[model samples]
Target: MKLSRLGPVGEEVPVVWEEDRAFDLRPLTADIDGAFLSSDPVAQVRVALADRRLPMVGEADALRVGAPIVRPSAVYCIGMNYAAHAAESGSAPPEHMVMFMKSPNTVVGPNDDVAVPRGSTKTDWEVELGIVIGARASYLESAADARLHIAGYVVANDLSERDWQIAVSGGQWSKGKSGPGFCPLGPALVTPDEIDASDLRLRSWVNGEPRQDSRTSDLIFGIEQIVWELSQYLILEPGDLILTGTPEGVALSGRFPYLTPGDIVELEIEGLGRQRQTVVAG
Candidate 1:
């Protein structure tokens, strides 16, 4: 079943999305966070649905959609995992995965407005497939082991500001990446059983024009490998979010102009759902 949170920010209640309507998920759990996911909630949701214990949500479409999961303890990102994206950014694919972090607080609802940081002229957009961790793991022995810890998948917009990332900040990327609503996630939190992440279409647009159009198959590093490798260096806590990297077709490539206030940015990943955000002044 598809899971989501709706209502005002920080007041979102969990719900399950079916074909025609949403079913209230609060009867099963208060929120879809680390604690709820670690309990093997999918099976529990199935049982709840079988018993008709969930009530249909009223006017769900009118409510705001929050990030499917709560603010994670950490938000990790893999950089240049797509070879074409690496080339566009003027680099060769690394022999080992490159990683970085975005402040967890940067996350916001899928359709919320995103602000271009003040005095910035190079805000860009990246569409990426996101992995949500369901179990804690450290020093995982293999990719198979890492796979067992996954909760599900999501669509993510990894917004960046080229100036802070490259011209300043001593070569650190997060400086440009941690602005308010820099990470807009969700519309749905798809369970693993409902999708195959190995290869899926990923696309993005700016103001109704197609920008990035690529596939997860182009990824140099897959999800399992990413998680397994990360476990070796640090702990992967439940509900942690990992952005699997974006494909080519961003403003950073210089083929397109950077985002400015009043621009509408849209991103999508097959099966995971879509996100649309309006650019606003910070």
Candidate 2:
């Protein structure tokens, strides 16, 4: 099942997408957040649909699509989880997983405008698969165990400002990554049963020109390993978002010019959905 939130920012109402239509789930819950997911939202939604209890809220195209879930406890990210991306950045595959964090405030609607940091010229884009956790996970025993904790997936654009990330921030990537609106997520949140998170294709483009084209098959550390490894150190809570990293083709590889004001960035994950954001000067 595909779930979503719609309406203006901060006023979004929970919804479920089925047969190309949007049904209001507000009667079942106030918002799609950690608490809602903890209640086995998918099962609840199923029962609601079976009972014909959901109301037809509005046409999918008529309402503004907000990020599928509400503010998460944290937004965790994996660095260079794709071997090719690691190589492009002049690094070898790491013996251990590399992790980072993006300020949760960076989150925004998938189609919202992305603001270029003031005086910045090295802004870049990364298309990644985002994992939404449904249960608390800590010190998981194996990758297989990690799989059971996943609730769903979403398309994510991990926007970055290269200078702040590498050259100017004393080596912390979050400095460049935590800019407001840097994380544009979702067209919808799709349950694990609805799609294969292991081998989906993810791509990105700037100003209608392809910049990154790759698949999750190329990930050095797949979703299961990422979740399992992260669990060893931090507790993965319901509604926590984990960006699994991007593939090789990115502006940071110096193959294309970095994003500029007025540039339109598009990102898509097969089966998950697509996102389009217009870049504007801060």
Candidate whose lDDT is highest: 1
In candidate 2, what are the lDDT values of residues 1-282, reduced to their tens digit? Answer: 999999999999899988788889987999989888878888999999889999988566888889999989999999988888999999998888889999998989999999999978899999999999998999999999987889899999999999999999887789999998999999899999899888998888888888788888888888999999999999999999999999988888988889888899999999999999999999
lDDT by residue for model 1 (1-282), tens: 689999998899899887858999988889999999999988999899989999988999999999999999999999999999999999999999999999999989999999999999999999999999999989999998977899999999999988998899697889988988899999888989899998999999999999999999889999899999999999999999999999999999989999998999999998888899999999
The residue pairs found clashing in candidate 2 are none
RMSDs, each prediction? 0.8, 0.9
Task: Work out how many backbone clashes candidate 2 has.
Answer: 0
Error of 1 at 44 (Å): 0.5
Q: In candidate 1, which residue pairs clash? A: none
Residue 247 alpha-carbon offset, candidate 1, angstroms? 0.4
At residue 271, what lDDT does model 1 achieve? 85
